[model samples]
Target: MVSITISAAKRTSLAKDLPATLNFPDKTVDTLTVSDVKSAFAAKYPQFYPSRQKISLKGDNKLLADEATLASVGLTDGAELAVKDLGAQISWTTVFVIEYIGPLVVHPLMYHFPSVFYRTTVEHSLLQKYVYAMVMLHFLKREYESLFVHRYSHGTMPFAYVFRNSFHYHVLGGVALAYAAYSPTYANTSSYIVGTIRDDPKFLMGGALVWLWAEVSNLKTHVTLRDLRPAGTKTRAIPYGYGFNKITCPNYFFEIVGWLVVCVMTGSYAAWFFLITGTYMMALWAMKKHRNYKKEFGKAYPKRNIMIPFIW
Candidate 1:
């Protein structure tokens, strides 16, 4: 009898075995079968080819050998064959959801819940819950750099340096806002009614406007503006062709104004603290980016001030 050889395709789970070709001597086996191959793998490596192993044979592009048919091939001992592991591949989509999508999308949406409670409650538990939610959102925000923004982008100074400075102010100010909104310490001690909230409609409207404007701007600047820079191209050199450069970082401008509105509406010292800190940090970062753009593009860059276009 002549030698029969078996081979498996490369770059698959089976490819780890070098030169997949196996030889069958003249008289040991009648014919190769899927069960015989699976049994060989099981006897050699039980954990990898457990009883659950599924093996099928195909010839002339047609399937062959149910369990019963496999048992009937009747090949002799030491008959050589190839086996492939058909276990499911790792789910990259699940990984993407956990690593990138969940924190950026899911967590923020859930964290905004404090304001909702503050809207409904005049009770102590409600006040405590609002503060607790704010604290949770604050801690959660530390992860934002890793998840929301790109890892690296060149500017005059390190992005982390600028971001961390701003982040510190942002969180502190936010904590103050939450404390002022829920805590009555300032309200009890304040000399002027203007310094403490007393359920004024104008302040509430301003706060709503600020918060709503920020949300809209966030969607536009981060999501909708859609800078189509090619892969590996430096984004700093790109002008704000979306036209927002008319007033640099209109999104950030709204963010500052929103916190101010919150401060007035809540009559909370904390809100003012946050507004001051967040705006200062953002102003620094925006100025750096603006300068970098002008330097990179020269006269081609639009004529615009750092924060306000015509006035400041």
Candidate 2:
């Protein structure tokens, strides 16, 4: 048997490793000694046991008594013992998303298309175009500053930020479409549609109204659902929870509707393209968040689908 000291917080974790076997002196039983553990670790992994620190012989998620306690319990020095490790594993979905979906597929396709399409002036008022440009700039800045650029404890990349950033485009596109309709820029235009070549003021108005309504709902609902610790103000917690939790990602849901409205108002194929893209991305994020909540809260999490009502 071995005498080992265990760390306070890690006791619960190391207890899980007790069932695994460890190295011991030759001619001894399958079990390890306290000295044998120290010696084996020092020789094999110099960095792990640089100095004598507390160690434990865990078995089946329980901490075994030290040598004295084991001796009292009638366990021999060579008796076999098991140990296990209780570290969380990486999810395969996270790997697939960061490696292929976020970087190679969704990001490049959805983000780059707008840059190419809006590269030139297409008869929309210069002022309106500039406003759209500002919105895009803000969207990019928020993603890079608040989400993408942050570091995390785990060895994972920033796909969540990318998904959130994409949602911004859906809403902003509708806003720009609608705002341009009444603005001095495109009011007197002879033709707005590309192929049909006609003035369509209703398209702009419809897109604008939807975008405005969606934004208001998103901001309000998000603020209502955020989680706050005692240190956090209720106001702060509500908004924060709305942004992070799966229970209330209303912003993403409304964003799709915003784009749909933009398409109906402006009659632009580009608008529909954005709607489809936003829907695909939001659905993935929502599902991932929902699974995480279920794992975290078990039966306590509020019953709700990603975006839709009970039907979804």
Candidate 3:
């Protein structure tokens, strides 16, 4: 038998009483994976589910992958491992659903019930109607993607993030943007006046075309990423084709472009604000994902900008 010491690097109230050691049968030690060690650890401390546990070799900064064999990672008899609690976790699907539901439902209410949102009913112009349709279409596509199309690497996220994400979509993207675009102030803007810049058929048509193009390109990028990993697995493969050739995260790039198109179409300060903030956040995400791809694939990974093409 091979005995391994298990110590809590960061202990929670529930993990304070966990046992200090786990034993592996001699026949299985060479074949046992990090996941097996986690399973054994969870058997003793049920509160630390596999997803919420971060395990590393004792005194080592690098984390152990669940799919890696203990022997392959240089673990042998008397090896010591440290476990850190990741706190409460909620499924990525649940977080996405919650985040999207707010915008999906709130934006329409703001559009249709101006009295409720703006405290008075106001006639919506044709341009406002068009903008509203685009917003609805965008969120609908997102909701669909979250439920059926997108695959997440980590199964769960910290529960606190759900509220932050929801606020960004619901408050900024839905309520604030809707009010700014559909309100009396927007209708009275110089661009909305008849024969003005915003009233030009060519401008509206061009904006619509760009928005549609961005949305479709974003969906294609997402599908390309989805096909890289099979369902029910966290396996990752380098994505190619479509926007992947030029940018690390084409989905984020396309999404930002779509929102920017909306801001142009609507001529709303609130929409522009939402686009700017969303773009900043997406850029951060793209940079992080780019770093991870480079780290994972080294020289084999394609050289590309993080999000923007040609220039980042």
Q: Best TM-score goes to which candidate?
A: 3
Measured against the true structure, the TM-scores of the candidates, in listed sequence, are: 0.45, 0.42, 0.91
Q: In candidate 3, which residue pairs clash?
A: none
Off by over 4 Å in 3: 26-28, 188-192
Flag regions of model 2 displaced more than 4 Å: 1-122, 125-203, 221-248
Best by lDDT: 3
| Top-down lDDT ranking | 3, 1, 2
Candidate 1 residues lying further than 4 Å off, grouped into runs, are 1-171, 185-198, 201-203, 224-233, 241-245
- C-alpha lDDT of residue 22 in model 3: 86
Candidate 3 lDDT over 102-148, as tens digits, reads 77787788778888877987777667777888988998898889988
Worst lDDT window (10 residues) for model 2?
229-238
lDDT tens string, model 2, 1-312? 243333232433323433334444342333444445545544543433412224444333444432324343344554443322223333323433332222223323333343343453334543234324433433443344233232222232344444555343534343333333323333234244333323434544445666667655654553344223222222222223443343446667765665565455545454466567768888898787667766767776766666664434
10 residues in a row with least lDDT, candidate 1: 150-159
lDDT of each: 0.45, 0.43, 0.84
User: What would you estimate as the lDDT of candidate 3?
Assistant: 0.84
The best-first sequence of candidates by TM-score reads 3, 1, 2
Candidate 1, clashing residue pairs?
173-274, 176-270, 177-270, 177-271
TM-score of 1: 0.45
